[model samples]
Target: MSYGWLDDDTTISTDLKTTKETPFYEPIVNNFETGGYNPSVSYHYNPDVTQYHYGVRHPMKPFRLMLTDHLVIAYKLYEQMDIYKPRRATKEELLEFHSDDYVKFLETVTPENATKLAQTLKKFNIGDDCPVFDGMYDYCQIYAGASLDASRKLISGMSDIAINWSGGLHHAKKHEPSGFCYVNDIVLSILDLLRVHPRVLYIDIDLHHGDGVQEAFYLTDRVMTVSFHKYNGEFFPGTGNHDETGLSKGKHFTLNVPLQDGIDDESYTRLFKSIMEPVIANFKPTAIVQQCGADSLGCDRLGCFNLNIKAHGECVKFIKSFGIPMLVVGGGGYTPRNVSRLWCYETGIMTNMKLNHKLPDELPFRNFFQPDYSLHPNLGDRLDNKNTKKYLENLKNQLLENLRYMKGAPSVAMQEIPPDLQNLTTDEEQAIIDKLNSESSYDEYLENERYWINEKDQARKHELVE
Candidate 1:
């Protein structure tokens, strides 16, 4: 179902009506100049046209105000980084991962078709989970293009790190749509990288498993898929069992760490450091893709975890610590306001920008919810819990065990198998051929891959002079 938070017309005006008497409406925008703002400081809030009468019925609306407020805070911080720029993704780039047919379908979907498509929601998997709104395709393309832009920036070497807070719709598949995702931008971006790099590492931190991406590359060793998410049982779209490793040459390439709910920052960090860090280091990938889904946060509507904002920030920090080219994307976050702020704060940290403490005075729908510093407050005040510490220690032990196992593990190099001379069955022979083909393509693939490497060189040159 389309969460009501996605409504475009719900603006700061709604928020003001609900919490006008509270201290939350204190204006904090007097100190900053609108002229210094980054054009990329996009605000998704739009005022509702219908005037509200006294005692008029309204849906649960405070969450949207929270998102807009957080975004205003984030945008103020983003200004310090000077990294907001829009870039387009080329057709060849999009086709790298997506089917030509699907790409064409996305381009052709119109408002009329959207209505008909909505009627047959099951056919397209576009009802409540992923509603076919008026501009759904356009929104998908914007995120898809933004992801492509981030990938291009990395490939070009313009910046070692980049983030598209709007991207990370990871549930979309090659031929079908699932969840709220219409396009698997992460997969497409990875496909774009395969053209330039021999090995790419993908990490998904969304509370839900990155099943769509895992399915796409289940048989390829060139891409290492690592996902850490909640897996209690049949939680949204299922899949992502630990045993669901890659097939053939890709068998051990996929790693699924199913975490329990209520995992706090310390435990989450320990899991990353102990398990993901070493695995990535050993793999020695040229690039990394991270989906920093905000749903993992404590107060998310759909999430069961208890992680605060600092915990989310730590995930970004940990990934960026690798010093490899990294692209950060946004994923699930039902508590739009909180998650947006979380991401905004993350972007600031990643870009080496100073974090701003203030928010806009008058926000769209500012009155919708009373801002009790206790209920939906800032992360600066929350303290780490004891459970977080214990979880970390447990994760450390797991990592130690894994490292010991790896010490006695076989070499990563593939063993050459001679062609079968005996008349083996065609199907059996084809399987072997497929494995060899995937392995052999790695070398020649990287050589001819044309990425935005030159553009990155130019951007870096420009940054140096500036």
Candidate 2:
């Protein structure tokens, strides 16, 4: 009767602004010069760009923007709750997952080496799906940093969950890159967590199999790689068969649920609930790594399945029910506008955070796509589909079968205490507090000290002598 894990308290008013006048007039009128000023004034701005519009010519552009928008929305909503803030990942953290040679190669890739590297596509698999772009290294670093920060949060116990929507580059290999992923952030984060927890479960529900991550931990019992993806025959990188369990100590550790194409939401939910719940319950993993790829949705150019956004939300909510300190990563999604909405909605569902649903007065993609209170026009209707019950049944059946195949492993629960909390001294805490205060003071100082570009512009000068 009730949905997976979410309660009725989850719903919120879809309105972005409480009232029309409140959105436009309040911020401007409350300027410091007016007595209605607040102690501190800060405004968050979203950029409007031509490339991010719905029908942008570039293939990756829209998807990239979609990821950004979802993250921005999540940031704003959580800012009100004061839940979690994103931070950059450090270099030391990156080395935990990436090979030294591969890391160095990424750093050295430039205009000169890029052309030469393009010639060596077979060697690195760089040109195939993961092409060497102009700023490929920078983007990899940024993604690596975000993934690292997420790991840090988990390790520090700052939050029970930390998600980097940009970080799940699952298809990237240790030495060779593939499938639009350069350095595998998922792998990196897993390795970082391994230092703290002996066992980790990585569950990927992307349409394409998580070949890179599965390969990295193929022989290790410490990590379990479970992926449910479309396996219609060597689709892209071509790995992850149900029979390909782990080697040696990793036997039965790697689980693959390769589904046929045209699979719908109901089937997905059944399979997820039945298989994942029992398997995870039996294994009793110390932490969870979930990759929520929007490509699994219907109409996504790259994906093969036909799952709706609600099904995706259901999966996230189910995962959150485990209540473990988990690191969530974003993976594939080609349909930019829809994917962004899907991810934004998923974030709220997983974190138990509410959506404002208010349209930012000037969204970056405003001119390109019409804005409705709901992220998508088709998804606006609240009516439940007739096929939902049947789909749920199908999903439950698939999950039941998959669970039978899984063998329960011994539960090794590692108590992980985050390094930040363990290491911070009273003096360190005071220093951080003082630093924040100093930064705020400096901001106030800069705001008050205004500079005139041209002194003449400040005072109108009319030469009567002329």
Most accurate candidate by lDDT = 2
What digit string (tens of lDDT, one per residue) describes model 1 on residues 15-92?
655444433222223224322222122222212201211112222122333453355452454343334445445455
Over 4 Å off, model 1: 1-75, 79-93, 109-111, 114-123, 354-466
State the lDDT at 164 in candidate 2.
70
**Per-model TM values vs. the true structure:** 0.65, 0.71
lDDT of 2 by residue, 334-383 (tens): 87676777766666555454444444445566443354644433432232
| Number of backbone-clashing residue pairs for each candidate, in the order shown | 27, 8
lDDT of all the models against the reference? 0.62, 0.65
Please give the distance, in angstroms, between residue 192's alpha carbon in candidate 2 and its true position after superposition: 0.9
